[model samples]
Target: MNARIPTDLSSSLKAEEDSNHSDNPSFDTVLAARLSRRGLLRGGAGTVGTVVLGGMGLTACGGGDDPAPTTPPAPGTPTETLLGFGAVAKSLADMVVVPAGYTASVLYALGDPLNAGTAAYKNDGTDTGFENRAGDHHDGMEWFGLDAAGKASATATARGLLAMNHEATTDELRSSFFLHANGGTTTLPRPAAEVDKETAIHGVSIVEVQQAAGKWTTVQNSAFNHRLTCLSDNIQLNGPARGNALMVTKYSTTGVQTRGTLNNCGTGKTPWGSFVTGEENWAGYFTRASTDDTARGGATAKSVVSLKRYGRNAGSRSRHGWETGGADDKYARWNVGQSGASLDGSDDYRNELNTFGYIVEMDAYDKTQMPRKRTALGRFAHESAAFGKPVVGQPLAVYMGDDSRGEYIYKFVSTKTWVAADANPANRITTGDSYLDAGKLYVAKFASDGSGSWVELAMSNPLISGYATYAFADQADVLVNARLAADAVGATKMDRPEWCSTNVNNGEIYFTLTNNSNRAIDSASMPPDSANPRVYEDTKGASTSKGNVNGHILRVKEGAAGNAALVFTWDVYVFGAESGAAAGSVNLSSLTSDQDFSSPDGLAFSPSTGILWIQTDDGAYTDVTNCMMLAALPGTVGDGAKKTLSYTKADTTTLSVDTYVGQAPTADKLKRFLVGPKSCEITGMCETPDGKAMFINIQHPGETTAMADIADPTKYASQWPSNAGYGAGKRPRSATIVITKTDGGRIGS
Candidate 1:
């Protein structure tokens, strides 16, 4: 009765890295004759010193003559050290855990109705109207405060709207309330009902939440409560790639619109108050027949090259096969192959694949507004976007990372200088169009000397135009085929870049380069660099894997050039390893029982207390402990010393390398905060403006449950957030947990 479980089914396997290579540019030593960290404090402070005073416009800056504030900012108010709550013990129980004086409660969960008319979730795979309920697999999210009139308020802390992306569905055995029946997979064209149900649960959810008596709960029937699914008809196409010929399809003859968003992963908050949802792993959701690659006209030789590069090669099967259902356009649009009569691909759904993989902007406070795909930001498995604090009359900058093995990191700089009046705008999407719609996208190229450059991907660049293979038409083509363009310009392929977080007090950026198995597969393979400096075998239970299984975090300092800088210094902040690993080679952080972790994924910086939070999405270390979240007080890039790494391969070959490693973590410096249940990933977090409450997401519990015990309630892999002493059920659900201090004080204070 159960479909065969895929042995290769993985949540994080996006792409192979060795396919692309970067011409590592030569540069001088990072810390040699250049101005040292101490020299900056004396005279050359520039943007680095100004940012350390509380970012671009977040705090006031004065000259030397200006006196300091009468009193220092409060301990929990974005400028001081974090020394409030004791570290929580790491746990594997099927429940949310917190520090001693904090409480964790489920605010909203999968299948929970947002409006009054919808029925509660049945949790039996028979429920309907998922478009009106909270979606599944909550990931990237942001908090938008609501004013007294229920409009978008940037200041209100107690009441606001939470917009979260439902990344993807769960495995059937691991989760009982999954979308389809009989193991949730079928080769025969999927049933239309199952397809519709699945589509309804894979987008963004906006729910109104408020705190009363120190506990937060959703506001039932609130006008702000809404769900934007993969089936929603109001998603509009915008920016350079809006009306391109490649985007034309039967659904949109003018290529001006698309139905929904897919694989919404990491997210960002726009300066003008909007939720920016990034599309990750969306290429796996379409079907392309084998013969389509040989077709003429719209299916040219360039199409074949681009499709294969993007992992949508000929004969590729859709992830869930919604295109295989009944022949209606609703089902047919999921197919992205040549079956149309028109030459420009307007008569069929061949171009439907071009409509996705974008950064979508939605007004969380306003439900009736349509979501716009800001294509100028460039696509390619977007993980998260972080904007530098805006400054008046200065260019706005946004940072991004492509979440695939051997992928490149990117940044976008707007042509127009920011005007302070636009911060509190009447229409946010209009403001977004002014800035995000017209920007120059650039890919990063990291050098061996601990410095890096941002290579512009515009058509005007000779490197992109002179590339002989793929044809470059305009800016639209460059943005649409961003990965190819990045490859063309020789951007440095990273070790699976994921969530990016920036300090509130300074513009220094930190991102997690989650483990990559392809780093050292053979003698000819790309070896470890200073940024990704590990190659070893990490065996969990019976499964064994080599390379950088326990990933590391990369820290970048923008220096005097600021966010728009082309050259910046970089170093490895910390390396994830077991407590018993070799000191200088593997266990660089010198982790102890309470601080050791593996494969760091989700990352965020507290705007209130300047603390860095690290979460895990790891299979490499699951046997030793469940996935967890940790908090640390970060120093700077050069605070660490350089060390050498050595590894012995299976073929009896030995390799040695050197990398910069951070200071050893003490009990007070880095410690585990909370741990999730069995087979779950801890991701997507946001906090109230007052820093009193925090919201974190737990995704895909029991994902490791075997297919044999799926139907038995007692044998279910995990009964979390529910049976973990919160709700009542045996089925596991991905839900958001709210953590607040029990004494009504600031969190971590």
Candidate 2:
């Protein structure tokens, strides 16, 4: 979710476009019948007891699961409480706020010098060399523990490498105003210097941080401090589509390599000790000429179909206008039109757009190693990749979500079974090659009866083999244009699926369905469904927003076979809403002011405590307070009964939908923990092995400031770390904060 662009211009941005025009059935009608037959919707509301299955699976690589409890409690021992902190109140202040006994301290921020050789950041628009400094808009992050000797250590608590994604920069009118003097140029032919700075800040950053004397500080000039900018080269393309013709580019004639990873939104830690991130909203960074379709053989051509299907229709403009930076190769690569003399696409960047939208893997500890794009995962607007519980002899599974209005959820199962010893192998990237390089990709098809199945997205599948819209060439084509394949297989369309996390205790998976603006009850294009059953109006000041104004969290329990199970059951873990909304409808979660939240985005389960940390990147609820994070001790699926909801259309017609509701959470089970500064989104969370310290990212404070007001400190929407007495200037910046208990106990305890 790039908040840099205002909502009024969303329709013009290809990345934010709703491209799904499939005729798949909504879940409303079938779900009502299923709930009625089961007698679960009898009393309007009910609570059902669910049986817990034993033999919880192992954590996937980078699924962020803490170590399991050492051993079961002795006979007669008392059970431990799930949560032990008071809820923090909602806030609209311009600073970070936490619960009473916790201390939130700033550890790293945008423009901060990563190495001693780089001069200090003045916080003004005159800073340069962003490739050697902290990138902007920090999002998903993962902690790679290190030993006292500066070696990789899974249990290290005092020192580690913080690898995170700098998704995008704050921009206005196609210019990154916050990064230039006089707000730079907004017209075409963008300056090369401004474009260079903007490009360097939209990738990934890995920096070392250490704790000494009860304080956390970034280790400047450390060997692990490195930046992979948009200009970085030598990124390997591994998987089924590595050397395919669709990937050929002037820089990589063999189609085995590509340039830097762009718009990385989420982070993962591989089971083999590597950092994995997803390229999200990368389609908007490339410009396609108006004559591209004609030059590539018209609208009926396979290349033209792919370009349009991925939101890169002919005549689309780049987000930052980077293509007009001159004729140099660095700037020319941004233009993804057909301008080459060869038909193979080896002489130009016409195929460069095919190289991104992947789950990129890199070793956080090895600065010399290049990141590898795992193409077998199936490319799209990937939000994040969360692995399932690893079973030693069973195939490993990685769950993913395509973050768009009507996209689908996906999973990739490795061909090779997992081996426990490989978790700590000598070479992490090589180990990734064994599992990530070859896999069977599947898209979820959720049914109306609260059941779902994983449909394979391979050439062998009849739906893809006989797809009428787009003829498939080979396996590589299916992987490169996976959205088309998913549609051909009749996969369920989700309401902007964002992040996926695996519960460590039972191996159940949870996905965050961030709100969808295009959803409607009466419209045929996108009607309300059982899985995504909501359409309401929320007013913020003088404006009103329709559709699913607030999102919800959906959790799934695998079948008897666990992660490898093709069949599964699902339920709405909670529907985000205002505390005062009508119950059994919008406020289905029954959340009080202390536990209410909207547009749940970032989700992670504490590996040590089993508490689920939920973060928000919201716009609907900003009128009440800034975005916040909450901690919850969630129950398993099927813990609650089913209920039917009816919506009144503008024409007075009744539209009903039956849905499975999870057990209602009390303040004790769920509570707000932190709220970020004004106009900021609280995202990306991780903790130390012991769970004593938690790291959270606050992104894009003061993002709404007008470009003309760049020099006026008072006109800024916010002055965050600076107002909090950090750094040198009044400019707002995205930064990472470390939270710890005052009494030296584990967080959330």
Q: Cα RMSD for candidate 2?
A: 7.8
* Model 2 regions more than 4 Å off: 3-8, 29-81, 648-653
Report the lDDT tens digits of candidate 1 across residue range 1-749: 00112244342123222334444321211111111112111111112112111111011112222223446467676443364445544445555555555666777888889888998766766678898998888887799998778877767888998999999886332222354444454445666777778888899999999987766889979987888888789688998998998788888889899998998989999888888988877877777887888874445587767776677767776666678678888888888888877888888887787788888998887767788998999978788888887888778888888877677788888878889888889888788889998878988877766777888998898888877667888889899889889988877767788888887877788888888776663424356666776666665555566767778888888757576677788888888877666565567788876677888888888877777889888876666567888888878887878776555555656655557777777767787777777778889889988787889888877766655555766776676756644444456778887877655666665
lDDT of 2 by residue, 1-749 (tens): 75224743464463535777777667662111111112121111112111111111000011111223456558777344556566666667677777655677788999988899999999888999999899999999999999989999999999999999999987677788878877889899999898998998889999999999989999998978989987898999999999999999999999999999998988788788898999988888898988899999999999888888788888888888898888899899999999989989999999999999999999999978878999999989988788898889999999999988888999999999999998999999889999999979999988777899999998999889999989999999999999999989988888889988999888889999988877876666678887888777776667677778789999999899876788999999999987777675678888877788888898999897999999999988786778989999999999987878875666766767778889999767898778788888888989999998999999999888888899899999988887766787888899998988766778887
Clashing pairs in 2: 58-390, 61-270, 61-271, 62-269, 66-607
Best by lDDT: 2
Question: How does each model score on lDDT?
Answer: 0.73, 0.83
Clashing pairs in 1: 78-608
